[model samples]
Target: MARTPTASAGRRSRTKTVLMGGVYVALLGLVSLIIAVAVATAYLPSYGELTKRSDLGQMIRVRAANGAVLVSLGPSFGEWLPYAEIPAEMRAAMIAVEDKRFRSHLGVDPIGIARSVKVRVDSGRWRQGGSTITQQLARNIFLTNSRTFGRKVKEIILALAIERKFSKNQILELYLNRVYFGGGAYGIDAASRRFFGHSADHLSLGEAAIIAGLVKAPSNYAPTADAEASRQRSGVVLNSMVENGFISAAAAAAVDPAEIRIQQTTRENSVRYFTDWALPQLDTLIDETSDPIDVWTTLNPGMQAAADRAIDAHTPRGVQGALVAIDRDGAVRALVGGKDYVDSIYNRATQAERQPGSAFKLFVYLTALESGMKPTDTIVDSPVTIDGWTPRNATRTHLGPVTLREAFSRSINTVSAKIGAQLGFSTIADMARRFGITSQLSTFPSMVLGTSEVRLIDMTRAFASVANRGVAVTPYGIRKVITADGRLLYQHEQNEERVLVAPWVAAEMVDLLQSAVMGGTGSAAQIGRPVAGKTGTTSSNKDGWFIGFSSGLTTGVWMGRDDARAVGNLQGGTAPARAFSAFMRVAVANRPVEQFETQVPIPDWQLTPEEQMFGDVAIDGNVLESMVDEDGMPLDQPGQPPVDQPFLQPGRPGDPSQQELDQAFPPQQAPPRANQYPQRPPPQQDPRSQPPANPSDPGAQLP
Candidate 1:
């Protein structure tokens, strides 16, 4: 009886305990519901407001340097599709590649997440994303790119909030707008235009597929950066389109893989040479702007094309060259740094420091002229050493005596050196500085040979001074920058500075340079019209240069190996002159021909009796010489009767000084008797040496 009573008590106690636990569980469940409701109610409204206030549709504006809109920064961060202008194929393609359940999912799709997780585990990598359209939108708007547990929690909260506040269409729009595409583009619209040079609405099925394919790895699939990778990814997108029923299997099969014309956007303002030179100037002009300002430079498209073509045609592949072309007023028209702008952005024309070679002699001559040294002054062209530095002419032999005009025309190194030494290196260096050569000029005597390095733009500007009639004009690219509302933000004016050389002196210099093209070192630069220029070839043939000006423009061209190695046998007259000629041919085609002004009239100064006998006279700012022929070739061959004519005797002159003048200006010597030409039947010696029997013979015409 006692045992029975105990068992009953135990059963009763167990029942009571069970009841108490149920009550406690019910109370705890009620509290959990209350806490969940409170948290949702507190955060849902703020999340809803965020989804409702998404500004993903705002347009981004991209303007030309001249205020013309090249393209607008499209809405959706970088999503740039014109409103309601996206094509059906593009939309279908996006949905096919990114989220097949885009339309059916509310904010989160449980089945999609499960499948994505399965795929990730099977692949042994997180290659698949389970985010629905709502999740993607939520992350883009409110979540950081943090893979932390807290960020994931916040992402889920934002996704739920977005689902409660916005419709499916709105979420899709936000998602598309906020997605990141590579190449500094944010949205599909910009990506489409940046990759294909067209709008989203204009994309073909293949193009749409390619763009949609980029979402997985934008940089990796960027067609400009990696065409093969992008093409392969496009195949994946095409396959997905077929698998997702967006495109028929037959349609996918019929699509030709090679027919996908992946056009790259041509960056019009990306001329590396000109842009490199113009960047610093742009910084100065827009230095005050908080944002980088677009610069619509005064670059002439035609001239720029010519410059690019010239450099490409002249420079060897992998070798670098730089060219600059400017209007007479100092407006930069065109610039080309290397063969291709995309290959490298370093602008050789504006940034490279190179030896100017004999091309810089123009400054020396101009300075001398400015300092009252007439172009006609007689100077000895004999071998001269300055402080153990012996400067020789390009031709190993000296001309004994020649006028300043002839020396300069021939690019005589020795004569140029003598002139520099006579005028003082500081004077020439100062003159170069005034012309805008900012590079440090070496104090050595070799500096007169353009041993100092200078940028192509600075040299071009210095030459422009001569073309601008001694008025130095600072070169500029940007004309103006303005706000979207036409508020003038920045403007550039013609900055001019009058240095030392007079307009007349510049004019005279121009005339003297014309001789260079007519029959001198720069004869290769002759177009059908009159041109004034100088050719420069450095020692060991490192840099080849030609800088010249026409009546309306001034241009500079440089050709050399990027590695600073010798360019074989290349000379300035070959590549640089050819480039200059080709560019000028196009640049001056439509302009009226204007002759360089002959500022100084020809002088009728009397020649002394000795000067007359030696055929030397001061005329037209240069000493006149009759010893050298019209082609600037010498008249006599030493130790032999002057080839075609009798040599003028030394002492049969009106004045005794005539002998001295003849000796000073004697002609070059022929080879020694032992090395004389094969002895032939000596022609019958005629008193007059009556010109060779063949009057029509070209050699007989030699002086």
Candidate 2:
């Protein structure tokens, strides 16, 4: 139907007005959205958050005594590179693989997010990441990698804020410099140098591709772990680059991933053991300082290598071994904790506690020596029971009468027990404590047999005192600790104390120990340099130990199964002695030969109160001389050990005649120079007499 011109014009005018009004409302809504975005961006964390410098993990450099880098632990970025310094190909590869529209997109990519959401919905899991490089950098710096919706919101806000605050080049530089690589390496510089042995500026196309691929999963695609997997990942990155038009197809195809040589920074297995032991020592001297620390250790690389070889060559399968070498000054030169550090990190040398067996007899004899008993004194090796605990000699034969030196050399258990009983368990314990054994000791008769367990390190340090002329020594490893800025934090100094009252006692001990290596159980340990040591074997052969020293060094070796099972006839003289010999040969190859210093004779006041009692009761020199047998055994004493139990002469089974007995106990013309009572000096409150010597002299009478 036709309408009048005025009515049609009116309806058309109303339609036009409605259309114009709708356009005005849409424009207002758009302005409001822009204002809201501007407000949110303004309220976001200040721009300084994106520009502030953050501290990356510091690098810890451990060096050997010779200035060789033993290990580099923690995160260390090789060098920081500006955006222009990074190779263009590296940037292209990272952008193509990590974010295709990195240059054009705001921090949050809507198209990528839509794609990721569709894929996640289809696969029923969050498989694909929709964030751009800016988002990743934001998360890495200010947020954790949690998959919660709140974290996603925070990431999107921070990414958009970063886009508003930082330039594209600045954002890219931060991303490249902060990304993590495998093997404790962080940033492109570190990744490039670690994988290709070249700086980031010199990275080849193929090398750049391999490093870029590690961003997805550093440990999984690390070149050191699986070169083929890393190569395949690099191929994917190269294809992405080509598809994104960042590189030509021909150029991408020309590069071969197989030719990329991964330069792996491998720490020496032996050096790692040393570092592990030394790292904890730093804390005692220095507290938590943000700066990096330099710890110089006393480990001798040559000696460490020698010790490693010795343990590997001598240790039986399923058996663990520990060795520690200490120099004359108590410096730990070499320490091998176990057969291998990789198989287990349990440091047996410093941690494990096992019976030292006869190695503990050194303390008992020292106590006896301090009590004025000479090494020439006779002690019956016949079997004796203490509290129903009978200890037989390892050889299973008793020498009816033997010199104290002979008893020690043979490692006679009965003689050691008798001597320990004579000194009283508490006295012996005090002696051991002074020598550096901190573990609790059992006071039973078996205590003399090392019934108490002790760490290998402590036992070795204890023996070092004997080597150092009676000065107690504490084992130390760290030589000095300095910060990166040249501040001295700690400097280890040798600590020595006079644990033994009489320095000459150490000399007498040296004599007896030398005899053991010369003709006794430790004969196999002789290294042709006047060596002295002891052999220790538990009853069931569960533990075998050899601790010995030359004039230059003292070493201890222990071998046994971890489960405490017997290893077929393993003795201290077998593998342990051989290992000691093998290691010492290399340890002292170029050093000058030195002899043990003569120990100053013990003074009279150093004797125990009981020993002084004898000095006070003066008797005729001839009578005192007659009282002791030729072998130095006190004769006709009250409570003398029974002699009729058993007797085995050298060439006969039955008891010998009086002539044989006389021959066995020959009269001593003079006591050992070390056994003589010192001549009394001018009287004081408690002045000691002269040193003991010249037993045949009338002044050498026993107390």
Candidate 3:
């Protein structure tokens, strides 16, 4: 190993060459960075534009159908707080979790980047981002969320520019105000008010930690989405705060996640589902608004509250229910997505597509009506076969011949199937389209039995058309939009009513629907006033529904589970109908009561004797005379009411209401024969009223 001077010289030369090559590479990288920054800067907004932060300052408020402020999405710029006013705990929690060395860093943190790279490498995934608060603010305001190397480079350059132009406090304030907090929330204040139901200044240590945790994955950890997941994420922030000395370890431990009170909405219950539905419509209605705007929705708060209560009271455990109420003009009055918005945000009213069961019969009947079928037309309730599918009545019994009105009110499957078969399934499907059902429908015979799945809103809207007297209704939630300066951004202007069927047909359908609520499966939906609706229970009891209209408002109720499992023995008549009545009682409490316009006698009022055998009201006097004992001694003490005692009066203590009776059978002229109604058998004669012969036997029956 003789090391000559030449060998030593060669090693030194190689070292110098390596150093020069590294220097050239470093210099080229620096020049490239400068070029990239210049290009990115050219694409960026002016400094004044960035500082103004208009997007951060703007918000959207949703109003009730009555114009009451329901909620505000985006930052509450009206209540925007200065850095000095923001809660110290919130600031500390944010600084500890989001950027530990925010104050010391210059727009970008090398240490943080190194840590992020190390974490991604160790975990084989991008577990965390290395962008500082300033970089996030820059990205949020000036760039789209494209996960590209170019975007990241621009983000860093813009962050540096922002840091140069603003102070640390200003950067923090802007970042806090501009950060997205999921659920259409854009700032700390809105998030605070939305989740904690208070101002940002009032956030507690635990609350602050939870809010800080929301920065990473707001939707996944939002209190409304998953309270448990939110709590765990908040715990991580609390630990981070402790590690950063922002809070003492003991203090963090004392804050129990379970005890945290998470108020999702300013109102105790949520109209979030309603807003969720309306927001997408906003996107389609308007391109974009530069300033904060107000969306005047068609939601009735009173009705919404009633809907909430009704669903809460009736929906069975482990199952869900939805209710949607619409006015004659298709204004969505009230909508309940689920019993609680926190448990589920998937709106069953507007989202879930379940079998409507017999509710879809509305289409079949409407088709028949348009095809010259009257409500009074005769239909056989006996078993019928369409293709190979045989339809059976829910009661497992059938009348030989029944009026169309009777068949509909009773939701007789055989009758509806036969009508569908006659009209052709495509005819019914076309009727459904005319009524506003946008979901795909089948032309199969079973579709008459509501085998086709549909959204509750679609069914409600379809019913709404019939309630609107055959005029088509397009269900809408937003009424108008306005800016803070009262400039109209959007206003709903109704065009001419699209007449889907003849008015008389709608009137006859109303007559049939009223009968259902009067004395049919939908009896549970009967309120004091007139109601026209139908009951729908799908096979295996998977879904129950009642869609009806009263006082110019159409309401539809659906009860089911999320997994499409059977809901025990739940039926539309009992749970959904009761819920509809309970909600309508309050929803229409203030609205004027109006009766549906119908042609007299509700069509087919005078079916043959065979038809009357199927429980017709208005019995023949001859039949009344025939109801007697074989003794033939006049069979009566004798003044006896014809027909059942309950049906003697339009409204008895336990009988259908007067409106139901009038709707059932409007009075025409006086009866031709006397004694048409033999008065009810005289009550056992009172002993005290009897003459002197009865006085001796006061305790005995009077002869």
Candidate 4:
């Protein structure tokens, strides 16, 4: 009996111990749950505070070198306005469009959230967001640009905390200050200013509705990007306002849609070509800081306008062209990459490499002139074949004998090839390199004809060197950058170096180029004043170019199709020259007229036999006084041709004057017959027959 009682007592004691342990575990679990809830509650308010203090709502402005606002990087936020400051119509529009239960809900609309969950569950994806205004504000302020459960949860927690700490009006005010509207505008006030160019307090009912509509998709409804979409969104907001009892249907219908005006922000985002080229130069002058910096450049707004107009007028539809203008000192004054910069951001002036064509011949001629060759030197214009490559003149027919000056003026291809062969190609290539033709030069002789490709800006710089008397100046866009407080951040000085030809040689080349504008290929580019220029038409007319310089400015224009095809039969002498002339006409209208120095007089010895022959050959005074027929035999001193008989039987050999006519037109008969004609004996070869080779040799490879 004693052992049985002991066993029962042991069993009862074990049961009691088990019951006590269960109770203790339940109590500990309850304590842990309470601690977790407390920690979450504590972190929620801190997250709200963090959202309030973040700088994500700030606006970032980009300024031009001349202190003009080019673009606003971030939201364009105006001054913070209280809820009271916001008009009732604006508030009503926001409530009707964004969240109808904004006032009654505790930061989360249960109905909206339930609908969003149902959508996600049905579609097996999170495609829709049911964020209230407060939640959106929280995300914009404190969260990263992510769409994940953790981030959503954080946003919700912050929103709940904000609602708990502030009244409905205060939360709405904060939300109004933090929302993003497209076009770099943030908050209701900035949106009002950006879209209407007015303060939020001055917003009309239709304007307020538009701003509220932008809350759904700012970029899609942005007035600047899509005016029709903005108008459609505004209609939706107006309908919502009527459905929510915020406005009567009759009053909404009475609103004239035409009266709603959307003032586009004229901040300079459209002129990206100029900014892209000028930004790097701007960086050298300004420090990285949030404060506004003003940059001053040498750019002339009028010149830039003229460049844009000229490009638009001359460039064919769907074709692309770029223009760059520099002052006498090599400061870039204007640049236009294409017809519409908004359609494409690639700055052709700095980025594209196209063949410069015959414009490059100037460098070749300059090189030869520097090497003791005169403009009057004679070069054979006959067929020239170098290393299996035959370069023909634009017109296949060649003048038997031509001076260097005439060859350059006429842009004769065979003569240029011959000149390249005489002067080592490497010498001309080296001169081009020194003058800032940084593009790769081909080893073949075609480089003498500008087979190498170059950018517009580089070509402008090279031409500017010629205008600046052989001193190559680095082209700069930004002159100086200053802080908002007027402190100088950086400044650019005139960085120049003497390269390639000497000053006198450069001056002489300039004079010759002026003749190009006066009567040669660049005649279309003549601007009344003294202008020196060269025209370049690439292979198959794929590219057209006109690079010219006046007394104070140098401009380069390029016209061609963006797809690398030929344009509407346009050559360098046509559209590009016209555009260059138009821009120069406007740019230099106020500047004083200046003349290029004339080339030094050619010495007598440097004259070639052909030039000497032409120098003495003269037409009869009677022929000059009256029109004559095809035959060289003079008409009867003025009305004598009426009785057209065999005049003097075409004088025989040994006739002094007849000898000159025979020399003029050599006999086309066989060689044996030529001996019978009145041809003067061939001149004896001088003992100094080994004259120096021509300075331009097409066979020689370029450096």
Error of 4 at 431 (Å): 2.2
All models, RMSD in angstroms: 16.5, 13.0, 16.7, 15.8
Which number leads on lDDT? 3
What is the C-alpha lDDT profile of model 1 across 1-703, one tens digit per residue? 3679889999999999999999999989767645644564466545335433234443334333333333333332223343366777777788888788888775667887788779978998666567776776667765776666676556656676666666666566555545766665556665776677666667787777788888778879888778778877878888999898888988777766567766543244445455455545645655454322344567776677778778878776667878888787778877777776677777788878999899889877886676556667778889887788898778898997887778888988888888777766666776787677888887577877889999888888887888777777677776676542355667777653543355667777887688777788888887788898898889999999998888578889998877789888778888789889988999889988888775644222232333334343443533345556788654553343454665555467554465565566664343334212112223363111111122234422212
Task: Please provide, for model 4 over 62-125, each residue's C-alpha lDDT reduced to its tens digit, 9 standing for 90 to 100.
Answer: 4444544455654566667778998898889988887889988877788988989999999998
Which residue pairs collide in model 3, if any? 376-603, 376-604, 639-679, 639-680, 640-678, 640-679, 641-679, 641-680
What's the best-to-worst order under TM-score?
2, 1, 4, 3
Order the candidate numbers by lDDT, best to worst: 3, 2, 4, 1
- lDDT, candidate 3, equals 0.79
As a TM-score, model 4 comes out at 0.63
- Shift of residue 222 alpha carbon in model 2, Å: 2.5
Query: What TM-score does each of the candidates earn?
Result: 0.68, 0.69, 0.57, 0.63
Model 2 agreement with the true structure over 617-702: per-residue lDDT tens digits: 22111225645579865455333323333434544756676687767665335443543332223435222122222334443222
The positional error of residue 418 in candidate 4, measured at the CA in angstroms, is 5.3
Error of 1 at 211 (Å): 3.7
In model 1, the clashing pairs are 60-73, 61-73, 65-296, 76-177, 78-187, 79-187, 375-622, 376-621, 376-622, 376-623
Total clashes in model 3, counting residue pairs 3 or more apart in sequence or in different chains: 8
